[model samples]
Target: MSEVAMKPEIRVLETADADTFWKLRLRGLKEDPEAFGASLADSVDATHEEICKRLACTDDSFALGAFNPEPCGMLGFYRRQGERVRHKGSIWGVYVAPEARGTGLARRLMVEAIERAKKMPGLEEVLLTVSTTQGPAMKLYESLGFKEYGHEVKALKQGDLYIDEKAMMLRLHD
Candidate 1:
Protein backbone atom coordinates (compact mmCIF):
# COMPACT_ATOMS: atom_id res chain seq x y z
CA MET A 1 0.00 0.00 0.00
CA SER A 2 1.11 3.56 -0.54
CA GLU A 3 2.60 5.20 2.54
CA VAL A 4 -0.17 7.72 2.58
CA ALA A 5 -2.70 4.93 2.52
CA MET A 6 -1.10 3.28 5.47
CA LYS A 7 -1.25 4.40 9.06
CA PRO A 8 1.54 6.78 9.90
CA GLU A 9 3.65 5.96 12.93
CA ILE A 10 3.10 8.33 15.83
CA ARG A 11 5.28 8.43 18.92
CA VAL A 12 7.01 10.74 21.35
CA LEU A 13 9.94 12.26 19.49
CA GLU A 14 13.48 11.67 20.70
CA THR A 15 16.70 13.62 20.34
CA ALA A 16 17.50 11.65 17.20
CA ASP A 17 14.44 13.08 15.51
CA ALA A 18 15.48 16.67 16.10
CA ASP A 19 16.60 17.37 12.55
CA THR A 20 13.37 16.17 11.02
CA PHE A 21 11.32 17.84 13.72
CA TRP A 22 13.08 21.14 13.28
CA LYS A 23 12.57 21.09 9.54
CA LEU A 24 8.88 20.29 9.88
CA ARG A 25 8.49 22.96 12.54
CA LEU A 26 10.11 25.54 10.30
CA ARG A 27 7.78 24.56 7.51
CA GLY A 28 4.81 25.05 9.77
CA LEU A 29 6.01 28.46 10.91
CA LYS A 30 6.66 29.60 7.39
CA GLU A 31 3.49 28.23 5.87
CA ASP A 32 1.16 29.51 8.57
CA PRO A 33 2.69 32.16 10.75
CA GLU A 34 -0.44 33.31 12.55
CA ALA A 35 -1.33 29.77 13.51
CA PHE A 36 1.64 29.67 15.86
CA GLY A 37 2.98 31.98 18.53
CA ALA A 38 6.48 31.45 17.19
CA SER A 39 7.96 33.20 14.18
CA LEU A 40 10.32 31.93 11.53
CA ALA A 41 12.77 34.65 12.44
CA ASP A 42 12.70 33.58 16.08
CA SER A 43 13.34 29.97 15.18
CA VAL A 44 15.61 30.41 12.18
CA ASP A 45 18.63 30.75 14.42
CA ALA A 46 17.91 27.72 16.61
CA THR A 47 20.89 25.44 16.76
CA HIS A 48 20.90 21.66 16.50
CA GLU A 49 21.71 21.33 20.20
CA GLU A 50 18.75 23.51 21.12
CA ILE A 51 16.41 21.41 19.01
CA CYS A 52 17.78 18.23 20.54
CA LYS A 53 17.31 19.61 24.04
CA ARG A 54 13.68 20.38 23.30
CA LEU A 55 13.08 16.79 22.20
CA ALA A 56 14.56 15.30 25.34
CA CYS A 57 11.30 14.02 26.74
CA THR A 58 10.74 13.79 30.45
CA ASP A 59 7.73 12.45 32.30
CA ASP A 60 6.17 15.91 32.27
CA SER A 61 7.25 17.33 28.93
CA PHE A 62 7.65 15.92 25.45
CA ALA A 63 6.82 16.34 21.79
CA LEU A 64 4.97 13.88 19.57
CA GLY A 65 5.67 13.38 15.91
CA ALA A 66 3.86 11.63 13.11
CA PHE A 67 6.01 10.02 10.49
CA ASN A 68 5.25 8.11 7.35
CA PRO A 69 9.01 7.62 7.37
CA GLU A 70 9.44 11.42 7.57
CA PRO A 71 8.09 14.00 9.97
CA CYS A 72 4.63 15.19 8.88
CA GLY A 73 2.99 16.43 12.08
CA MET A 74 4.09 17.61 15.52
CA LEU A 75 2.77 18.66 18.93
CA GLY A 76 4.39 19.70 22.18
CA PHE A 77 3.20 19.23 25.74
CA TYR A 78 4.61 20.39 29.06
CA ARG A 79 3.32 20.27 32.61
CA ARG A 80 3.87 23.20 34.94
CA GLN A 81 6.41 22.64 37.71
CA GLY A 82 5.52 25.01 40.52
CA GLU A 83 4.01 23.27 43.54
CA ARG A 84 0.95 25.50 43.28
CA VAL A 85 0.42 24.88 39.56
CA ARG A 86 1.82 21.44 38.87
CA HIS A 87 -1.66 20.12 38.30
CA LYS A 88 -1.88 21.91 34.98
CA GLY A 89 -0.23 21.22 31.66
CA SER A 90 -0.20 23.11 28.39
CA ILE A 91 -0.25 21.98 24.76
CA TRP A 92 1.56 23.97 22.12
CA GLY A 93 2.91 23.99 18.60
CA VAL A 94 0.44 21.71 16.94
CA TYR A 95 0.95 21.36 13.22
CA VAL A 96 0.26 18.91 10.42
CA ALA A 97 1.71 19.21 6.97
CA PRO A 98 -0.72 19.95 4.17
CA GLU A 99 -0.29 16.49 2.73
CA ALA A 100 -1.16 15.00 6.10
CA ARG A 101 -4.31 17.03 6.53
CA GLY A 102 -7.77 15.35 6.28
CA THR A 103 -6.25 12.12 7.48
CA GLY A 104 -7.47 12.54 11.07
CA LEU A 105 -3.84 12.97 12.10
CA ALA A 106 -4.43 16.08 14.23
CA ARG A 107 -7.13 14.45 16.31
CA ARG A 108 -5.02 11.35 16.72
CA LEU A 109 -2.12 13.43 17.98
CA MET A 110 -4.33 15.27 20.46
CA VAL A 111 -5.85 12.03 21.77
CA GLU A 112 -2.37 10.68 22.34
CA ALA A 113 -1.34 13.80 24.22
CA ILE A 114 -4.49 13.77 26.34
CA GLU A 115 -3.95 10.14 27.18
CA ARG A 116 -0.43 10.90 28.30
CA ALA A 117 -1.62 13.87 30.33
CA LYS A 118 -4.16 11.66 32.09
CA LYS A 119 -1.31 9.43 33.17
CA MET A 120 0.71 12.15 34.83
CA PRO A 121 0.27 12.29 38.58
CA GLY A 122 -1.47 15.37 39.97
CA LEU A 123 -2.36 16.62 36.50
CA GLU A 124 -5.96 17.75 36.73
CA GLU A 125 -6.32 19.64 33.48
CA VAL A 126 -4.70 20.31 30.13
CA LEU A 127 -4.70 23.80 28.65
CA LEU A 128 -4.20 25.02 25.09
CA THR A 129 -4.52 28.28 23.24
CA VAL A 130 -5.86 28.26 19.68
CA SER A 131 -5.89 31.28 17.44
CA THR A 132 -9.42 32.33 16.65
CA THR A 133 -8.58 31.93 12.99
CA GLN A 134 -8.08 28.23 13.58
CA GLY A 135 -11.71 27.31 13.67
CA PRO A 136 -11.17 23.64 12.90
CA ALA A 137 -8.64 23.30 15.68
CA MET A 138 -10.93 25.02 18.16
CA LYS A 139 -13.71 22.66 17.20
CA LEU A 140 -11.44 19.63 17.51
CA TYR A 141 -10.40 20.71 21.01
CA GLU A 142 -14.02 21.21 21.95
CA SER A 143 -14.89 17.78 20.57
CA LEU A 144 -12.24 16.33 22.84
CA GLY A 145 -13.90 17.78 25.95
CA PHE A 146 -12.01 21.07 26.15
CA LYS A 147 -14.06 24.10 27.18
CA GLU A 148 -13.29 27.68 26.37
CA TYR A 149 -12.48 29.52 29.59
CA GLY A 150 -11.09 32.75 28.23
CA HIS A 151 -10.25 34.70 25.11
CA GLU A 152 -7.22 36.90 24.58
CA VAL A 153 -7.49 39.63 22.02
CA LYS A 154 -4.30 40.38 20.17
CA ALA A 155 -2.80 37.33 21.74
CA LEU A 156 -0.28 37.09 18.94
CA LYS A 157 1.04 39.65 16.49
CA GLN A 158 2.70 38.79 13.22
CA GLY A 159 3.93 41.81 11.30
CA ASP A 160 1.37 44.25 12.66
CA LEU A 161 -1.45 41.73 12.15
CA TYR A 162 -3.13 40.82 15.42
CA ILE A 163 -4.32 37.31 16.10
CA ASP A 164 -6.88 36.75 18.83
CA GLU A 165 -6.79 33.46 20.70
CA LYS A 166 -9.11 31.39 22.79
CA ALA A 167 -7.86 29.58 25.85
CA MET A 168 -9.42 26.19 26.37
CA MET A 169 -9.09 23.68 29.16
CA LEU A 170 -9.86 20.00 29.46
CA ARG A 171 -10.50 18.86 33.02
CA LEU A 172 -9.09 15.41 33.56
CA HIS A 173 -9.84 15.09 37.23
CA ASP A 174 -12.03 16.56 39.95
Candidate 2:
Protein backbone atom coordinates (compact mmCIF):
# COMPACT_ATOMS: atom_id res chain seq x y z
CA MET A 1 0.00 0.00 0.00
CA SER A 2 1.12 3.56 -0.71
CA GLU A 3 1.60 6.12 2.02
CA VAL A 4 -0.33 9.36 2.35
CA ALA A 5 1.56 12.59 2.85
CA MET A 6 0.54 15.53 5.00
CA LYS A 7 1.65 19.10 4.33
CA PRO A 8 3.34 21.12 7.02
CA GLU A 9 2.35 24.67 7.95
CA ILE A 10 5.44 26.76 8.57
CA ARG A 11 5.80 29.53 11.13
CA VAL A 12 8.42 31.38 13.12
CA LEU A 13 8.92 29.52 16.38
CA GLU A 14 8.23 31.41 19.62
CA THR A 15 9.56 31.27 23.19
CA ALA A 16 6.67 28.99 24.10
CA ASP A 17 7.95 26.39 21.63
CA ALA A 18 11.37 26.13 23.26
CA ASP A 19 10.82 22.72 24.82
CA THR A 20 9.39 21.17 21.70
CA PHE A 21 11.99 22.71 19.48
CA TRP A 22 14.80 21.72 21.81
CA LYS A 23 13.62 18.13 21.98
CA LEU A 24 13.57 17.89 18.20
CA ARG A 25 16.91 19.62 17.92
CA LEU A 26 18.48 17.11 20.25
CA ARG A 27 16.93 14.27 18.28
CA GLY A 28 18.42 15.57 15.05
CA LEU A 29 21.87 15.84 16.53
CA LYS A 30 21.68 12.39 18.04
CA GLU A 31 20.02 10.55 15.18
CA ASP A 32 22.02 12.18 12.40
CA PRO A 33 25.46 13.03 13.61
CA GLU A 34 27.09 13.73 10.24
CA ALA A 35 24.39 16.13 9.10
CA PHE A 36 25.20 18.69 11.79
CA GLY A 37 28.17 20.65 12.96
CA ALA A 38 27.08 20.38 16.60
CA SER A 39 27.14 17.14 18.58
CA LEU A 40 24.42 15.64 20.76
CA ALA A 41 26.84 14.99 23.58
CA ASP A 42 27.86 18.62 23.56
CA SER A 43 24.32 19.97 23.77
CA VAL A 44 22.25 17.22 25.40
CA ASP A 45 22.33 18.91 28.78
CA ALA A 46 21.21 22.34 27.52
CA THR A 47 18.55 23.84 29.76
CA HIS A 48 15.06 24.90 28.76
CA GLU A 49 16.02 28.45 29.68
CA GLU A 50 18.84 28.36 27.16
CA ILE A 51 16.54 27.03 24.49
CA CYS A 52 14.01 29.74 25.34
CA LYS A 53 16.65 32.40 24.86
CA ARG A 54 17.32 30.95 21.40
CA LEU A 55 13.65 30.89 20.50
CA ALA A 56 13.65 34.61 21.16
CA CYS A 57 14.16 36.34 17.82
CA THR A 58 15.70 39.66 16.95
CA ASP A 59 15.61 41.70 13.73
CA ASP A 60 18.41 39.54 12.33
CA SER A 61 18.02 35.96 13.45
CA PHE A 62 15.34 33.37 14.18
CA ALA A 63 14.22 29.78 13.80
CA LEU A 64 11.35 28.61 11.62
CA GLY A 65 9.23 25.63 12.62
CA ALA A 66 7.16 23.29 10.45
CA PHE A 67 3.89 22.29 12.04
CA ASN A 68 1.55 19.52 10.99
CA PRO A 69 -0.24 20.66 14.18
CA GLU A 70 2.97 19.69 15.95
CA PRO A 71 6.56 20.85 15.61
CA CYS A 72 8.02 18.43 13.06
CA GLY A 73 10.91 20.34 11.55
CA MET A 74 13.05 23.44 12.06
CA LEU A 75 15.48 25.71 10.22
CA GLY A 76 17.35 28.67 11.63
CA PHE A 77 18.64 31.84 9.96
CA TYR A 78 21.18 34.22 11.46
CA ARG A 79 22.70 37.40 10.06
CA ARG A 80 26.34 38.21 10.54
CA GLN A 81 26.86 40.72 13.32
CA GLY A 82 29.55 43.10 12.12
CA GLU A 83 28.60 46.06 9.92
CA ARG A 84 30.81 44.82 7.09
CA VAL A 85 29.40 41.29 7.30
CA ARG A 86 25.74 42.11 7.84
CA HIS A 87 25.02 41.55 4.18
CA LYS A 88 25.34 37.79 4.63
CA GLY A 89 23.40 35.19 6.58
CA SER A 90 23.64 31.48 7.37
CA ILE A 91 21.08 28.70 7.53
CA TRP A 92 21.66 26.33 10.41
CA GLY A 93 20.20 23.45 12.38
CA VAL A 94 17.89 22.29 9.62
CA TYR A 95 16.13 19.09 10.67
CA VAL A 96 12.94 17.26 9.81
CA ALA A 97 11.42 14.39 11.76
CA PRO A 98 12.13 11.03 10.04
CA GLU A 99 8.47 10.20 9.66
CA ALA A 100 8.00 13.53 7.88
CA ARG A 101 10.57 12.91 5.16
CA GLY A 102 9.53 12.83 1.46
CA THR A 103 6.58 15.09 2.32
CA GLY A 104 8.28 18.23 0.91
CA LEU A 105 8.43 19.63 4.42
CA ALA A 106 12.17 20.34 4.23
CA ARG A 107 11.88 22.18 0.95
CA ARG A 108 9.11 24.27 2.44
CA LEU A 109 11.24 25.06 5.47
CA MET A 110 14.17 26.17 3.30
CA VAL A 111 11.94 28.26 1.10
CA GLU A 112 10.46 29.96 4.14
CA ALA A 113 13.90 30.60 5.62
CA ILE A 114 15.28 31.94 2.35
CA GLU A 115 12.29 34.18 1.77
CA ARG A 116 12.72 35.60 5.25
CA ALA A 117 16.44 36.08 4.65
CA LYS A 118 15.76 38.00 1.46
CA LYS A 119 13.73 40.49 3.44
CA MET A 120 16.41 41.10 6.03
CA PRO A 121 18.03 44.53 5.62
CA GLY A 122 21.32 44.48 3.70
CA LEU A 123 21.31 40.67 3.41
CA GLU A 124 22.17 39.60 -0.13
CA GLU A 125 22.88 35.90 0.32
CA VAL A 126 22.45 32.86 2.56
CA LEU A 127 24.98 30.11 3.12
CA LEU A 128 25.05 26.52 4.38
CA THR A 129 27.35 23.51 4.67
CA VAL A 130 26.26 19.98 3.95
CA SER A 131 28.16 16.74 4.32
CA THR A 132 29.36 15.29 1.01
CA THR A 133 27.72 11.98 1.76
CA GLN A 134 24.30 13.53 2.18
CA GLY A 135 23.40 13.43 -1.49
CA PRO A 136 19.67 13.82 -1.06
CA ALA A 137 20.11 16.90 1.09
CA MET A 138 22.69 18.36 -1.33
CA LYS A 139 20.31 17.77 -4.20
CA LEU A 140 17.53 19.58 -2.37
CA TYR A 141 19.77 22.58 -1.67
CA GLU A 142 20.92 22.67 -5.28
CA SER A 143 17.36 22.45 -6.53
CA LEU A 144 16.57 25.43 -4.31
CA GLY A 145 19.42 27.46 -5.92
CA PHE A 146 22.20 26.95 -3.41
CA LYS A 147 25.48 26.52 -5.34
CA GLU A 148 28.62 24.87 -4.18
CA TYR A 149 31.41 27.38 -3.57
CA GLY A 150 34.09 25.31 -1.83
CA HIS A 151 34.84 22.13 0.06
CA GLU A 152 36.46 21.22 3.32
CA VAL A 153 38.05 17.87 4.00
CA LYS A 154 37.46 16.13 7.29
CA ALA A 155 35.34 19.00 8.52
CA LEU A 156 33.53 16.95 11.13
CA LYS A 157 34.75 13.92 13.06
CA GLN A 158 32.86 11.49 15.23
CA GLY A 159 35.48 9.23 16.79
CA ASP A 160 37.78 8.14 13.91
CA LEU A 161 35.34 8.74 11.08
CA TYR A 162 35.73 12.05 9.25
CA ILE A 163 33.02 13.72 7.21
CA ASP A 164 33.60 16.35 4.57
CA GLU A 165 31.26 19.20 3.67
CA LYS A 166 30.68 21.44 0.70
CA ALA A 167 30.20 25.10 1.32
CA MET A 168 27.12 26.34 -0.50
CA MET A 169 25.42 29.68 -1.01
CA LEU A 170 22.28 31.10 -2.56
CA ARG A 171 22.29 34.68 -3.79
CA LEU A 172 19.27 36.82 -3.02
CA HIS A 173 20.40 39.93 -4.85
CA ASP A 174 21.61 40.71 -8.34
Q: Cα lDDT of model 2 overall?
A: 0.89
Residue 99, model 1: lDDT of 92
* Cα lDDT of model 1 by residue, 24-116, tens digit: 999999998889888999998899999987776998899999998788999999999999999999999999999989889999999999999
Give the 10-residue window scoring lowest on summed lDDT in candidate 1.
1-10
Positional deviation of 172 in candidate 2, in angstroms? 0.4
Instruction: Please write out the lDDT profile of model 2 over residues 10-126, one tens digit for every residue.
Output: 899898888989989999998888999999988888888878777668899999998877789998888889988999999998899998898788998998888888888789989
TM-score of 1: 0.95
Off by over 4 Å in 1: 2-5
Note the Cα lDDT for every prediction shown: 0.92, 0.89
Best by TM-score: 1
TM of each candidate vs. truth: 0.95, 0.94
